[model samples]
Target chain A: MIAPVRVGQAVRLAEWAPGAPIELSEIPANSAKEFILPASETIGRYDRDGARFTMRETTPEGPRTVLLGVRPCEAAGLAIVDAVFNWDSRDEFYDARRAATTVVATACAQADADCFCTSVGGAPGATRGADVMLRLADGGRQFIVESLSARGEELLRSAHGVTEGEAAADPLADVPVRFSHERVTGWLAGQFDSPRWQEFSLACLGCAACAYLCPTCHCFDIQDESTRTAGVRYRNWDACGLGLFTQHTSGHNPRADQMARWRQRVMHKFSYYPEKFGMLACTGCGRCARMCPAGMAISDTCRAIDAEESSPG
Target chain B: MSIAEARDEAPGVRTFRLTFTDEPARARFFGQYRVGMFGLYGLPGEGESTFCVASPPTRTEYIECTFRRAGRVTTALQDRGVGESITFRGPYGNSFPVDAWRGRNVLFVAGGIALPPVRSVIWNILDRRPEFGDVTIVYGARAVADLVYKHELADWQQRGDVRLVTTVDPGGETADWKGQVGFVPAVLEQAAPSAGNCVAVVCGPPVMIKFTLPVLSKLGFAAGDIYTTLENRMKCGLGKCGRCNVGSAYVCKDGPVFTLEQLHRLPSGDM
Candidate 1:
């Protein structure tokens, strides 16, 4: 499983079939220009000029991939997706993408005002979702690529550019993450009765931006689209925050109010997910906190619920 | 939860039971397998129109569940035949604690198809007949011809330990309509069951449960003392899917059969 870096060229992923560096942006563009990539490699499809552009793999199915130089939060987002994707009825499409992609994450040394990964349960260098995490170690020179998953180890073994070395045994011990998952989960579990959901829900724009931006939010809906003769049933991600997400065919909506919808978000991650899967759905990556214009911090809300629960009655 | 097992029940209904199917291992968890949070003996696909175990949970000769052709999951279940498969996750909802009711009078009120869940309670009660006080069953339906498990009810009526009261609406469709008429609530009110030391179990459509609770109340039944089953859209049964929420409580996890006090505390009105 171990290989040495070759001379005079950057590491080549088995994905490229030949040696060359394909930046993250180039892959999507390459898929649009050439239809040579594997069908499953097409993570998503874009329709333009009656043509489709797909970012995909070299084969229909393959081992893990080296998605080099991905942002740490983006890497963290992948962990969030695991909750809903693997939930009761597994989504093959999402599962396939997750299986194919091997993230070598680079931590964010500089976090913005919106960054609250630590607040929720992640840090600027959060590795909750990363298979192999690449930190700006040695002052941003040789990346401190630590393997967080067995898949991470396999990808690092295949990495052609770097020298393999023993990982720092305590990667996050000294790293200032500023969040406690135990506290977050403890708070989330008892938060089912909290009133903060009402106020937080009011602040929500209900545009489904939080679900779309977050790496972990994986709400999807299945639709049977068809022509006169043929129909294909495809499932696309859906968000509970959407006004019409839970609307029945007869116009009956269970989460008619923002409060109920907001409650579902917290419950899905903390309560419903844990009760079913025995783990929290959220990695506390805080992507929703960073991207939302409403200035809502999911961490703060969860912590508030936890604090309320622990306070003397 | 994919279908691990399937079979056809009486008439048009189908009973699909799932244990666990660990893919990498290429084996299934059946009967007594307790995978994760579920007991691993119930069918999950038949969405949460909750039904009690017609057969025993521990008696897993065939993880028994008998569902009629009703709403969504039942409709799908009805179409399924023996050996046909469907997705499911659990026997996740709450069950009647039969052991606790030992030596206590158990009153089962079944209104129409509601007997399926009540049957489990009744069967368990009768199975250990020596453990309980007198058993009284008051069952009614829209018409005499539509009563489920008719022959069984008639047999139970003849038995010495069980007192079976059968009734139908005013318009009697069957020739054997000697029993009382009017609704189950009206009949229960007329019978005047004493409130002391007895558990009254009721299950039916939403309207029936709503009206029957008052009758139990009139008989001096406390909210905590009264027990009934609930029905809702339960896709996962494992409480993962959001459909079965009655507040923070997922009915599939908290209950199909719950005390009245528990129902009153549910945050979401979906109950």
Candidate 2:
């Protein structure tokens, strides 16, 4: 089983042994994005012979696998990015990996301070992107596994377990909604030039940790790494918060400062993405808030925007 | 694609006329090609850079692209000689509505380094000259040395059917310069082409566009009659890379070409 297991001080997705420890209480520091859009991947290769060159296209071969015991928010994150990769020009690389993998989401039984799934149209047991749902039952001793898709039923038929019984599931995690996403999005649409952006993003360090650990942040950069004779074109992960993300070759940047960059991050997920793609780009995984060294949280920002929306001039 | 011919336009800008080695690919490219549509030019060791297809679809034998040696890819593209191979990945994005402008007058306003995009539209209209009405081109540059497509500028100047007014900024003209000596906005107001039955295509730097739009408006041109292209920084060009967006608009997909009326709906601060 591929599940979230502790690696040093952080939790990440790894191969799970029969007796290996898995973290069910907290979401992983790294998300399922690594399994789909990896940090770096080769898209094409070329060989040059003096003035002549031959091009070679690379086809991704995705193996069949099952993601076991991921949180619902992590599972929902995949659905958000799925819309982007398949919008108009389908990304064959992302499509191949996504099509091969089956998602098995575990309903959250505990909520942490960083978790805010309820605020963003997701719940602890949401079945948005999961093929199978596993709810903890019998005081964590057992899980009530239910198939949500045909792939889930196929997985269950091939598994080693042979039990046919029913049990009442435990109470779901209590995650309070911190802010109204509708209010925040409405506020963001009119606040592109608001001074609140500067105040809200004052502590941002521009480290891009939020984007890196985010489940739905899918921006990428393409580059060629090679010697004089041969080279491979690679697609690597890129973040908008990085200073070079929007910098022109002529040395002009549209989103120049951290304030603008921070505003872009929030606006892209809440305002712009929703207007274009019909869904928010965030799944409320809360990894960005948890991993930020500067203690900045997108939920806090949203709450502030919501408060401002209710405030009278 | 192989570079058939290369020409140096400005100090750092160069143009490459490319012919496809694969016959079917060339056929496919021209079949879908249009003016204002862009392409990604690249070398094996250097990544691809996005730029407009400078040549028009009317000249179907070969396509041309003009670029400045600003970044690594453009530098590498300029370093390659004739007969050298490079990768091209476009004719992507929306294009100008030249077909819609048939039987109507067309005025083109362009500034330094921005002429390549407008040049495609100018040549497109000229190739089918009988279908369109009167044509006027107002082009300007910071200095005479910064002007791109100098040969084409001279060709338009000599054409009896085309009215070409070229300009250089004050103090930018040389001793032998014959063009008007003023800024693009000022020169455009002086030319004062009639707004009736006329559609204007404008492309320039932000400051140039900022001042020129008001001049066009004052000259009785409606917001919808003026078209311009947005030059947002892009990577994938397929809309998934997520950097080429202004507000909710993906410049690579929805634009490169937009009317002034459409631009008014978007947040100006984001631009």
Supply the TM-score for candidate 2: 0.98
Return the TM-scores of chain A for each candidate in numbered order: 0.67, 0.97
What is candidate 1's CAPRI-style docking category based on DockQ?
Answer: incorrect
What TM-score number comes out for model 1? 0.61
Q: Which candidate has the highest DockQ of all?
A: 2
Per-residue lDDT of A141-179 in model 2, one digit per residue for the tens? 888888999989898888777488988899999999999
TM-score of chain B of 2: 0.98
Each candidate's DockQ:
0.06, 0.79
lDDT string for model 2 (B179-233, tens) is 9999999999999999999999999988999999999999999999999998888
Q: Is the docking of candidate 2 incorrect, acceptable, medium or high quality?
A: medium
- In model 2, what are the clashing residue pairs, if there are any? none
